[model samples]
Target: MTTLTTKLIQQSDARGSALAVISDDLSLTWRELCDFSLRCSTMLRDKGIEKGDRVALLCSNRPAFLVAWFGLANIGAVTVSLNTGLVGEGLRYSVTQCSAKAVMIERAILDAKRADLEPVLEGRTVIVFDGEQDLFAVLSGLAADAPYEGLGSDPLSIIYTSGTTGLPKGVLNCHEAFLASGRWMSRYLKITEADRIMVFLPLFHTNPQMYAVMSALEVGCTLVIRPKFSVSNFFDDARRFDCTMFTYVGTVLSMLTSRIKTPDRNHKLTRCVGGGCPAEVWRAMQERFGIDPHELYGMTEVGGWVTGNSAENYRFGSCGKARPDVDVQVFDPQDNPVPAGTPGEIVVRPKAPFTILLGYWDNPKATWESSRNFWFHTGDAGTLDQDGYLYFLGRLKEIIRRGGENISPFEIETALLDHPDIADAAVVAVPDPIFGEEIKAVVVAKRDFPPQDVRHFLEGRVAQFMLPRYVQFVDEIPRTETQKIQRRQLQENDRGMIDLQGVEEHA
Candidate 1:
């Protein structure tokens, strides 16, 4: 009874109850979902996938992702979900990192990136999700019934890092680790059979699948899936599916609020869940969109969600309190615990009854580094208040050390977003001879507003040094498929693209 797996939740659903998942053209219930997953698991096992094997899913958000996540978890096989948006080099990097035994991809998607993927998964099995060589043809024809052998602590996934920093490294999380994440999230979110969570973020990312689907399944909550997040159809999707809760991030909320009209202002969602909400936007978004913005802090390496802004009980700028079973502390350089309100590295240890990830896949150095002192160093800098509310202060690597001042880009970006003409802003440090690094802001201006207007809007609101030297406007900031701005990329690109002559000339 202590052990947890997706099959247990699948079996918990009533015979004819509604538990839905939506792909582009298909929507299915719990009964059908379980059956489909069982069949898929059988086919995969028959194809020599055993306990602890990594099976890469290279398809986009689809019904197959839901089925594959459960089916793999059911049989103790690891599900490595790869983002389909990864192109030539990026696609190759992920596949190579995963070192998966097989990949389940859509033909159209695979065809587009064949040159890159062909070599990476060369000897491995390549099962298509759509077209002639579809997984349905192979899995459906197999015997539907198979003895499920679930491995408790064996690896459940080797999710590759987003490669925003450099190259993507595979983060290995075990079955028990995922089980704990799901259970804790269920408790934190107060998920119940009455709750119908809507998911639109890519399944490849841990948030949507682990926090959204797995957490819902654990509580027997109905799932409303979307292939991709659509700003135009978001509310309509929620209303159509009767979703009580939806997972969100900064960009998703930004997109939702950007439009002139919010059709379903008092929409169905009770709370829009996930992290990275600016404090200024949080109140306005709640007032305008009619949903409580619940924030959570997470990384792919450390299972799914670590902490979340609890519903009903809210914190202004903090992500939230840690789960009852999570051991969290803010530590300085030598790993000594820091005082409240002091920014330090966030470390987490598995509390009793829950499991922690073993390490990063095939990268012993990273594994050792991340797992030092029996704590998972999250590489994020944050402060915990006296009341235990954890305020996120961006990633440690993303923080800019400028003119003896440690500036949080998140603070600058949040400030810029307050501007009327700016739709979104990303701040990164560009090379500066004087201050060591200079602040440069790349903004996505509102369609109606020009770059000059946005630059003028932020002139006096922020400090002279804190203000971005270069304000470059683009149609859209380069972002991961998950909508996180790739700041490292922006920083690298800014060297050539931005004009840093004036502001740093004083420095």
Candidate 2:
């Protein structure tokens, strides 16, 4: 089996002279990157980490993170990436859940920000990269060319799910599966050495890390890393790096369009790819930015993207066709495949060269539950168009039932996002006296805009009952570390804040 280590070798052979990764002030050729990763791998080994061990990494998006990822994999170690944004019990839960053997974190996060997490690091060895007490000072200088033992089929990385429903579940991605997903992306995305990819999303997420980072490395493409997304300076950074493409989420697209400064699309960037872009947002963004944008549907549990819109056959409001060697079907509650244009649960079956996850780490029941009927059930609702374009509706569990009427939060949230004053919106079901459940919207309005403005805008667009009965304005929508809006968290908050009175009168 060809492992990710082999992929790096292939890229190095194909374009040894080409730049593989770029940061604000650094650039690494394929050979140099391999050398760095090898040295880092040896350093990790000297620290008692070996093949099949779980090493938790908590740091910002930097060259070191990528080095650690592939370096650990080089020696057959499984990397567990924790979201540094997580605080208190939530962060601690992820550390304990993974049963991590060692943790490497940035001291700024441990010492300055959340000192409480230090207790969890009491027994475990802590390596604070680039801190006052630097980890490298204690260790001997390691050689770059460490013997690479091929550990194919062994676990390479364990990504924790965003925990939309509950506690985050660790999804194990083996070396074979990780490479398979990367190859599929490289072939489908048409990545090449000439391409300079911009990655603003966190590497902890599957889409950006796999599609943006791994796909580029697989094809010898240059990766221009952004520590995080910044709407104000995104275009400037893209221009500086001469980036040909970038990965995005729906929130990033919305933030770009909300800005007064429009981006020029004539140079460099051909397209931006990611998932959850609303139809209207796409149109407005294309007009404002002059760049064609594509959407992809993926989950961490599945390694990477299962479907994506590409240049050859682009479709609006669709997450593209099923990937090669992957089967995507919309199944009913009974596991029967529904015809095109009917909404159902999305499920996937892997073919040759596509690595399906072995199981959820330490959760056999969930692993079985997600893989029923020889298919991996992706808990998401989608409908396939006649052209085989998959249109994501919403999460199956997130569906709101009011007075026996089922409502999709995606529909209502999209409607609210269309309002000019509304910066962001999330719809969730709240407990109601008579209806059993009612629609409540949490909104983040643009500066100088009021909640009444949003309510008035939605008055004519949707049915009276479909309107949000209660609207709470927040400074920002709470997002997972991946920038995915946590609608479930909003629902929990609405339980305490929503007002029961004042239903919209029928027009």
Best by lDDT: 2
Q: How close is candidate 2 to the true structure, as a TM-score?
A: 0.92
Task: For each candidate, give its TM-score against the true structure.
Answer: 0.90, 0.92
Ten contiguous residues minimizing lDDT sum, candidate 1: 1-10
**Candidate 1, 400-497: lDDT as tens digits:** 88998888888888888787677778998887899988888888766665434544566686666676667676777888766777887777664334
Find the candidate with the highest TM-score and give its number: 2
Clashes of each: 1, 0
Report lDDT (CA) for all predictions: 0.74, 0.78
Q: Per-residue alpha-carbon lDDT of model 2 for 1-507, expressed as tens digits?
A: 766677787777778778988887567788767767777787888788877888888877777678778788888888998877788888887788888888887767667545657667767766668631243333236686454667557788888888666788889988777776667776766777788999888877777777788778667889998888997788888788999888887578877876744556756777788887877778976876776777888887776778888767678888998877788899999999999899899999887543767789999999999999999999999899888899898888887889987678888888888877778888889888899888888877776654445567777787777777777877878877676678777877743343424433422
Find the 10 residues in a row with the least total lDDT in model 2: 131-140
Model 1 error, position 174 (Å): 1.5
Question: C-alpha displacement of 135 in model 2, angstroms?
Answer: 8.1
